[model samples]
Target: MEATLSLTDKSGVADVRRRAIHMAQALGLSEKLQADAALIVTEAATNIIKYAGQGEITLKSFLEGASQGLEIIALDRGPGITNLASARTDGYSTGGSLGAGLGTIARHSALFDIYSVPGNGTALLARIADSRDGALNGFQIGAKSTPKPGQAVCGDAWGVRQIGTHLWIALLDGLGHGPLAAEAANRAVSIFLLAELSDKPADVLRRVHQGIKTTRGAVMAVALFDTDKRMMSFAGVGNIVGIVSSGSETEHLISTDGTVGYNMRTVRPSDVAWSKGSVFIATTDGLSTRWNLNRHPGLTDRHPSLIANVLYRDFARDADDATIIVVKAT
Candidate 1:
C-alpha cells in the first residue's frame, strides 16, 4: 500500500524509471498508461537532478475492492522554483532545453499539483487512476506554521470550513522566522478565514498565494475532512508535513515542491481519501521528521495548539521556527 524511493544520484534516476515501470505493469495499467507514467517519472527525476541536485520519491497505492490507483510524490530541498508560471509554460526553462517539465507531467497524470518557494523547497504530487471505481472524491489535507518560544504570536493562522457535514482546515508557516513568518502565516489564515466560507481548497490556496505576493511567502497545507464520505483531502507546499494516524499505524506526508511567494505560480493540488479512525497532523520543518512517533502516541489526540507546543517542546531543532496543527475525526 505504501512504498518509498530515493533519487540521490545519477543511477537513481534510471532505477526510479525501471521501478515505476515495474509497478505500473504489476498494477495492470494499460500499456499506454504504463508508458505515460514511466515517461513522467523519468521527466520528474530529471527535473530533480537539474533543479534540486538531490531528491526522494514516494509511491503509494490504494485499492478499495476492485479499484486501484497510485499517488506519486517527489520531494526536494533545493534552490526552489523562482517562476512557476514560466516554468510550467510550454518553453520555459532555466537550463534552456525546452522548459516543459511541469507541463508534461500535468498532461500525463489524471491529477497533478506543484508547490514551491524561493530559498525554501519544492513538492510535486501526481495521481493516476486505473479505473473509474478507483477515483475518490473524498479529501486530502495538511497544515504547517511557526511557533516561537515567547513571542506575542502576531502572525499565527488557522481556519475551518464546512461543506454539508464535511469540514476543512488550513494552517500556514510564513517565510523567515519570528514576526515575519508569523505575519505571513497570519495573512494566510486571514485569507482562509474569508475564503473558506464558500470556496474550494484549491481556490483558497490560489488566493493565499496571490495575497502573499507583496509580503514574504509562506508554506501552507489545506485539509478537507468529509464526514459523509469519511475521507480527508489535502494539498501543501514548502516545509509543511502532514501525517495520518489510524490506530497504531501512522503515515507521514512530506511536501512535493516548494513554498509560496516570490516565484510560485498557481499550483494544482492533490487529494487523498482518508479511512476511518485516521488522525491528521501538519507542521513546519522546524519539527524534525526524525522525531519518534512511537514514543509520542498521544500526539494524535491532542488539540492543534497543544500539538504544536508538544512538537516544539520535544523535537524543535531551535535553530528554526516551529508550528503544528492536529485534527482527528471521531
Candidate 2:
C-alpha cells in the first residue's frame, strides 16, 4: 500500500511520523523498525522545509513472498543539492547545523539514492527491507539526459534486470503529476528491483497492482528480452506505450487491458517477438500519439537518454507527467 503526505511546516513532520507509525503498525513492522523509519522521515521532511521551502513525501510498502519493506521518497523543486559530497558528510550542512541529513538517511535505510542538479531540484529515495533474506537488484539503467527549458518530467519510470541470460525491462507512469506522481513512479521501480527474478511479467504486474492499492494506480508495461530465443515478451496495462524498433521498421506493444493497482480484474499479459538491431521505448501519455513508428526512424541508434530527450522534445505535452524508458539490444 502507498500513502502520500505533504510537508509544508513543522506539523507536516508530525503528520509523516504518524503516518509512518500507522503503516508500520498495520504492516507489523517491529517497534525498532517503526521508530527508525519515523525518525528518518522526520529528518527528511525537515530538510525539505529548511532547504526547499516546501516539499512532498510518499511512503509505500512492498511485499513479495516472504520479503517485505517500505520505500520513502522526498521531493522538491527548491534549490537543488549544492554539494552532494559535502552534503553527505557527517558534519556538513548548508543551514549551519550538523550536516547529518544524508548520512542519517543512509544509516537508517537499507538503500538510499539521491539525484539532484544545481538549478533543477532534488529527489531523495530510501528503502528499508524487512528481512535480511531479500537482495537488491539494480535496474539496467542507461544514461541521464538534460531536460529542455520549460519541460517538466511526467514521472515515467523504468528498470532492467538480468536473470540468467534473459533481460527484463519494465516501465511505469504514476497517476497525476508533481511529487505524488514521482513517489508512485519511484515505488514502482523499487518494487521491480526487489521482486523475485522468477516471477512472470503478469505476476509481477499483479503484485505491483496489489502493492499500490492505497494510492493512485499507475500504467505499467514489462518486457523480457530472451537472447537465446531471440524473442521479446511483453505485458502491459493502462496507457503506457512500448515500441520495438528494428533496422528498418518499428512495432508497438499493446497492453492487456485495465490499469495497475485498481480495476485489475480486466488486466492481462501480452507478448511479442524480438531480435538484434532492435530497441524498445516505453513512455507515458504525455507523448502525443500523433508521432508513430514511421516518423521516429533510427531513434534507437542514439543513446537511451537521447531517445527519451528526442521524444520529450518532439511530442510531450505540458499537461501531465511524461516519462520514457528506452532499451536497445547491442
Candidate 3:
C-alpha cells in the first residue's frame, strides 16, 4: 500500500498520522511499531507545517531483504536547513515548538536519511522494520513509484528476483496513466515472477511481450546483475532510461525504440563491467532527462533509497506515472 498525502496545515498532520497508522496495521507491524510510525510521520508533518509551510508525506509498504514494513519520504520546498547536523540533535528547535524531530525519528527507524540544500529544499527518508524481521541482506535496492496526480494506480511497475549473487531487476511503464495502463504493468510483473531464472534480458522481454499483449502494452527494461562476475546485462523496449555510474564517470544502457507486446523490434541486450561502489539506475520517462547527479555533492554515498528520493524530489515531471529503481551491487 502507498499514498502521497499533502500537508497544507496543522489539520493535515492528523490526517497523515492516521493514514500512517492504518498502513502500519495493514502491513502487520506490531503495536509498538505502529506507534513509532505514528510518531515519525506526525513529527515529519509538523515540521513541514511549522517550517516548509506546505509539503508532502508519502507512506509506502516495502519488502527489502528479509524485512517488511513502512517507508516514509517527506518533501518540502521551503527554506532549507542550513546546518543539518545541528538540527538532528534532540531538543533542538528553530521555531517555538517541541524539540522532538530528526533524532527521535532516527532512533525509531531502522534506516534514516536526509538530504537538503539551502533554498533548494529537503528530502528525508525513514524505514521502519516489522518486529519479526531485523536483518537485511542480498542486493541493496531502492525505488519510488508515484502515480499521476488524480490517479488511483500508477501505470509503472517493477519486480526484483535474486538467487545467490545473480540479481534480476525489471522496470515497466505501461502505455499511459490510470487503470488501462496499470493493467499492462501488473500483467507484465506476473509473467516476470514465473519466468525462468536463466532467462536473459531479451528472453524476459519477449516472454512479457507475449504475455501482456492483451493489455494496453508497455515499455519495459530488464537488467541482470551478476555480482560475482562483476557484469551487468540489460535489454529493453521504448524509452526507459538505464544508467551506470561510478565515481565521476557514467555509461548508458541501450534500449530499442519500440513498444513491447505491440510493435516490438528485435530484442538486443548490452553489458557493462561493474566497478567498486558502482550504482545502476533505471527510470521511466516521467522524469526530466536533464537531471545530473554532480549537482549534489556526497549524495552517491547515501542509501539507494535516499538517492532515488533526491532524484524524484528534484526532477519528477508531476504529469505522469513516475518510477525509479536504484540498485547497488553487494
lDDT of each: 0.66, 0.69, 0.86
> Per-prediction TM-score, please?
0.50, 0.54, 0.92
Tens digits of per-residue lDDT for model 1, 1-330: 445577777788888878777887777778887777777777777788878888877666645324566667776778778888877876566764335568877777766777655665566766666553432234333333434545545344666665556777887777766678777887888888787455666677788888988888887888777777666667777667777777777666645466676655555565555665466777666778676555544445533323443444457775566666666554
Least well predicted 10-residue stretch by lDDT in candidate 1: 134-143
Q: Taking the tens digit of each residue's C-alpha lDDT, what string does model 2 give over 1-330?
A: 777677778778889989988887788888888887887787788788888888778787854224577767777767777788878877567674335668877887765667665655566766666663333231123322222224354466777677666888788777766556657766877787777877778778888887887767788888877777778788888887778877776677788667677776555665556665577787777777665644444445654534554565457675665667776665
* Of 1 and 2, the candidate ranking higher by TM-score: 2
Write down the lDDT that model 2 would get. 0.69
Clashes of each: 24, 3, 0
lDDT of 1 at 122: 65
From the highest lDDT down, the ranking of the candidates is 3, 2, 1
Q: Which tens-of-lDDT digit does each residue in 1-330 have in candidate 3?
A: 788899898999999999999999998888999998888898888888998999999999887767779999998988889999988999888885567768888999877889888887778888888543432344578888889988988999999887887888899999989999999998998898888988998999999999988888999999988868889899999999989888777888889999988999998889988755788988998888777686777677767887888888888999999999998755
Which clashing pairs does model 3 show? none
Over 4 Å off in model 2, which ranges?
Answer: 64-66, 96-99, 132-222, 227-239, 242-281, 286-330
Best by TM-score: 3
**RMSD (Cα, Å) of model 1:** 18.0
